[model samples]
Target chain A: MSDKRGSRAADRTEAIMRTALELGEEIGYAKLSIEAVATRAGVGKHTVYRRWSSKGALFLDSLLSLNEAHLDYPDTGDVIADLRQQIHAAINLLDRAPVGPLYRALIGEALLNPQVAAALNDHFITPQAEKTVARLKAARDQGQLSPDFDLDLAMGILSGPLYFQALIIQKPLTHEYVDRVIDALFTGMGPRP
Target chain B: MSDKRGSRAADRTEAIMRTALELGEEIGYAKLSIEAVATRAGVGKHTVYRRWSSKGALFLDSLLSLNEAHLDYPDTGDVIADLRQQIHAAINLLDRAPVGPLYRALIGEALLNPQVAAALNDHFITPQAEKTVARLKAARDQGQLSPDFDLDLAMGILSGPLYFQALIIQKPLTHEYVDRVIDALFTGMGPRP
Candidate 1:
């Protein structure tokens, strides 16, 4: 393909993805369809199928395109504090419109479809988890966290409650909730010393 | 109503519920329809709908009937040990055939349907959480657990990581994993004293 043709294809792909995200946010995952996305984008349904194989794949792409930066973990010499800040930001993103319902929809899809589950794990869940693990590893090296605890398990422990509340319970997450989780992890929930 | 009719009605109800559970385990929640379940139960579709309004409702009822006793928290006078024991049993139930996949389907349905989500919360999630909380309260009263942390949050902390691994990551839940979680909760994950 010529340079102009390549640029035009890229633009059309972006338009379709943008349309998918919008329809997803508006109608949710259960109702959103590739046909609807194509119609809204003024493209043929075949155009969409030619590019992405399924609705889950399209939505996954659209979600990753826009929301990757918001969840980046920061390091500032305090592991707990950094975790608190990042989790608060994550909860804020996940609790609000677009990302929250979109993510919920994706998770719902992932549960039913193995392909979506594998793709979601590969593109989104694993990468984000690895980022958190890297931060925890740094903290472990600095003696901020015990080397005794499994870092992978620690990652799940840090994240599981937030996902449980946000996704399973469909509750709004609060900064106070983030702090409580961090404190529980740091101070331990055992008897008073 | 006559005694004969009442007994027949009860028998029919049990048959329908048993069929729902079996079919749910066989085909999962997505493809298991009211029509299919009714057909399998040797009842009319309207008969299935008469007792339970939706598939989620039916599955919730079926799940509760068989699995409730397995999750009953033991009060062994040690909160952490009790939690460890109960969680192990719960994981064993959720990790295997029948209950595991059936519960996953219910959760997937819950994510997509508000009515199912509400029903799941009312019937399954909230009740199990309360049982755990009640156990934790006893521990708090006995000075085994610090009175500072929120028991509700504690419940999430206890269960979330396990759910995250089992449901989201699609990983096997092991006894050793349960022990690690309970240990983290009891011993804390912060720097060594």
Candidate 2:
């Protein structure tokens, strides 16, 4: 029965994390609460405190709970195509209300709250950013891009427009807009004769 | 002379806008007020009320006050050089605490407040964005870019990275980083040989 106990604990943890994400999206980080999360998840308040030190800690874990969505980074051999697909997917996710507001709130919180910022940077932001870098480095290795191509700059060119349009400018993150942005970056990064 | 009265009115308007921008940065939008702004500008509160309908309106005008800094959109015949210089100047402005926090706060406020968003989009965002598009169109006309280039998308590629870095990612806006971004976009947007 020890194994059963472990699995039950895991299930409870999953439920709590899922509830935290939902509450975070519905009401936002500013209004999200540990007490609400405990009651909604059908667990005791101490259960949450046992796992997370504070609301920010709980929210950070909830943010990571959504990372499964990013696992399928496209790798179709054509680096440009893969990059475009990945960015398009990201834009689509951001367009969804459940994910978009939560993400923006997290970013705003990151700007104002150091603990939240550190959690996001250490757990969510840096790892995902590194994946983008790795993909570009792989493309560079395959001779799909120029030898002198700056990987960091190429990564920025590829992803920057999407975030700028969707997040900062608050524009509609449509497929057409994504294509235009990708085409512009690829033309800039294409192999020179 | 009537000229003396006109100049005094202009000076008062300038002072009010300046104070609004300063107070907005020092505290933030949530706590900013017309009364405080009027007091800071050495004008009566009714004077502020007479000009602007609300604090958001006043702050929007304050934002426009800084637009003179961007008036010199370089047209030196070298489109790439001019673009780089323009973007570099923008990055520098964003890096400063005065304009930077105010800009970020506006964005944050925009997410939560529709009135502020409308004011920003109608006045500050759209008008400034059009100028960038105009500059690119001028370059395309000069054969510095392809005839078929999407001017809107090109604008996103050029400005998006700077904003994505400084605003969202909260990275330091360095001259070297700006140069790399410009080089990447120009390479993508350069005339297809």
lDDT winner: 1
lDDT of 1: 0.83
List each model's interface RMSD: 1.3, 3.7
Expressed as tens digits, the lDDT of each residue in B16-87 for candidate 2 is 998888788788877998899988888899999998877777887787677657744788987777877877
Worst 10 residues of 2 chain A by lDDT: A184-193
Model 2, residue pairs in steric clash: A187-B188, A188-B187, A188-B188
Docking class of 1: medium
Candidate 1, DockQ score (0 to 1): 0.68
Looking at model 2, residue A159 earns an lDDT score of 64
**Candidate 1 structure quality by residue, lDDT tens digits, B34-123:** 999999889999998888888898888887777669799888898878888898888877778778777887888788799899888888
Query: Where in model 1 is the C-alpha error above 4 Å?
Result: A1-13, A31-53, B1-10, B42-51
